[model samples]
Target chain A: MSYELYYWTGIQGRGEFVRLALEDARAAYTDVAREEGDDVMSAWLDGEHEGALPFAPPFLKSGRLVIAQVANILHYLGPRHGQVPDSEAKRIYAHQLQLTITDLVVEAHDVHHPVGAGAYYEDQKTEARRRAKEFRESRIPKFLQYFEKALERGGGRHALREFSYVDLSLFQVMSGLDYAFPKAMSRHDVPLLRALAKRVAERPNVAGYLASDRRLPHSENGIFRHYPELDA
Target chain B: MSYELYYWTGIQGRGEFVRLALEDARAAYTDVAREEGDDVMSAWLDGEHEGALPFAPPFLKSGRLVIAQVANILHYLGPRHGQVPDSEAKRIYAHQLQLTITDLVVEAHDVHHPVGAGAYYEDQKTEARRRAKEFRESRIPKFLQYFEKALERGGGRHALREFSYVDLSLFQVMSGLDYAFPKAMSRHDVPLLRALAKRVAERPNVAGYLASDRRLPHSENGIFRHYPELDA
Candidate 1:
């Protein structure tokens, strides 16, 4: 049976991470919201469907299991799709890296919606300016450096000994960061991550997905937005 | 063998979630930073150790494995400590609940540091006021209602069919919220969560831990801070 993935039908939000893995593994799955409508995703959120309740979207339904939380979902998929190493220790390490990525993603999103998600970016422009400055100057460099160091430790080829979901997610993050903060990212130097992103982008499946209509472009509506005022 | 938990010395922060589970399970573990010093924890962050580097502290070292991220650490500990159900489905449900708690915790912390963690709360007092208003009025109730519903689904006493780390973490979150925003929390009604918190506190091991010096008090230094002006 094909897996059913439920997320909002616009600019690759958190759901993109899942899509990348599914595409890379050549796993047969349905992007339910995109194929149908937001109402289908809303039904799950409203508890009209079975399985577990997700606090938000980007949930996966594989058979009877309904998994949420990007890292949690990836953790489940990584082993199944041969995206992680066999050893338990290495799998734990990959997850820790992914969780750190999750933290960075939250920080990146908060730059545009610093005050609260309820308010529009125009309303919170001033707060976003303050947040964006910190994120660009300190936070981004800090996270990038960490990932670069990890990549170096893992032989500078993949996030681990071999290709894993962490590499795919990192590619997505690097892509998002490039879209969101071209100016600031240009100043920071992360040679290993740049190469990894390049390699991930060139992967046959990923390259095909990028060239296909399935891939969505980043917009102001998504987590990683290119706000000229927010970018230094 | 005992586990070595490395977190910042004074504040509970994210480390408290792990601490609660260890205490509840009566697991042998050392709050390493509290025992040794911040330098011991700083060494791990600096990557002087052999294990995988954590982006920050609140990492647990067991045998050769070093697990970071509160939810990830709890996921590891829950199974070994028998804090989760024996079945895979139940454990995943428990973890999904824990991750939701993680999201709520981040939002709660951001109320004080909306601009960025690099700046002081005093410098961002005006921003905190705005963030706190949304947090108290909207975010907290939404999360509380979700947890209450989850609790109702699992059987009113626990976050799962049996007592698990999710319930323990939920108790810690409720206690922190009460300390942070007593006025706002008092206004919202979540009978199931309130009852679960009370029951968790009465657990003999947890009650003992609460009375001991090991459990730190909530303060401005921690994730959940009570600023009278930010409250109400």
Candidate 2:
């Protein structure tokens, strides 16, 4: 059976990570919210689903099972789509890397919504400036350094030396960050990550998907919003 | 071989979630950072470890494999300790619940450090107040309601009807929240979660561990910090 993904229809956001994997593997899946409406995603969140209820969106349904959380969904997809290694040890390692990416994603999202998720960005602009400063100066460098080191350790190819879902995620995150913070992310500094993003985009299916109408553009409503003043 | 857990020695922070599972299963493991020093954790984060490098603390090392991220570590431990169901679908459900708990933990932490992780609470007190307000008013109720609904669906016993690592982590999170937000979390409001926490604490191994010196007290440094002004 084909997988069914539920997420917001407008922006890439977290759902893009799952979309990249599905597209790369050429897996058959439906973007439920996009085809249907926002009510479908809200209905699931309101416990209208039969199985496990997700706390948030970007959840995947496969046959009888439903899974949420971007990293968790990717973990389930990785092995099934041959995106991750078969060895248990390597699989777990890939998960660790994916979890780190999740952390980075949260921080990226917080750059705009620093005070609280419930509050509007305009209300928290002062706090956002402070948070974004720290994110751009320290957090970005630290996280990029960690990934760069991991790439160095993994022979500077993929997150695990093989084309795993982690690489796809890394590519997506790097692309988002580049779009979000064009000034902060220097090509000279994050050479390995930049190269990986380029290579992943060049992949047959991934490239096709990127150029296709199926790919959504980043927006202020999404996680990686490009606010000029917030960028260094 | 015994598992080795590395985390901060002081407060029962993120590491406590892992500790609860280990203690509940009566698994043999060493609190390496507590016995050794913070240098051990720092060294690992600095990529001094042989295998996967954790972005932060509370990573587990079992024989040749090392795993990080609280939810990921618990996901690995759940099946190994029989805390999760053997079925793949149920196991993934347990993980989805655990990841939700992780989200709550991060939100709880952000209540204190809303502006920046690098900045002190005093430095971000204004932002903290705003963040804490939203957390206490909206986020707490939403998360508790979700868990309450899950409990209702799972027959009000454990997160999955059976005693899984999700229960252990949920117990830890509820306990921390009680200590952190005595005003926000009332017995009348979250009866199911309150009962679950009570039942979890009454477990033989868990009770013994809580009363033992191995159980660390909640401090200002941990995720769930009790700032009087922030609570109400």
Evaluate residue A193 in candidate 1 and report its C-alpha lDDT on the 0 to 100 scale.
Answer: 97
B179-212 in candidate 1: lDDT tens per residue?
A: 9999999998899999999999999999999999
Q: What are the per-model numbers of colliding residue pairs? A: 0, 0
Pick by DockQ: which candidate is best? 2
Residue by residue across A1-232, what tens digits does model 1's lDDT show? 7989999998799999999999999899999999898888777777777768888988999999999888888999999999999998888899999989989989999999998998999989989999999999999999999899889889899888699999999999999999999999999889999999999999999999999999999999999999988888
Off by over 4 Å in 1: none
Per-prediction DockQ, in order? Answer: 0.85, 0.87
- State TM-scores per candidate: 0.99, 0.98
**Candidate 2 chain A, poorest ten consecutive residues by summed lDDT:** A185-194
TM-score for candidate 1, residues paired by index = 0.99
In order of the candidates, what TM-score does chain B achieve? 0.98, 0.97
lDDT of every predicted structure (CA atoms)? 0.91, 0.90
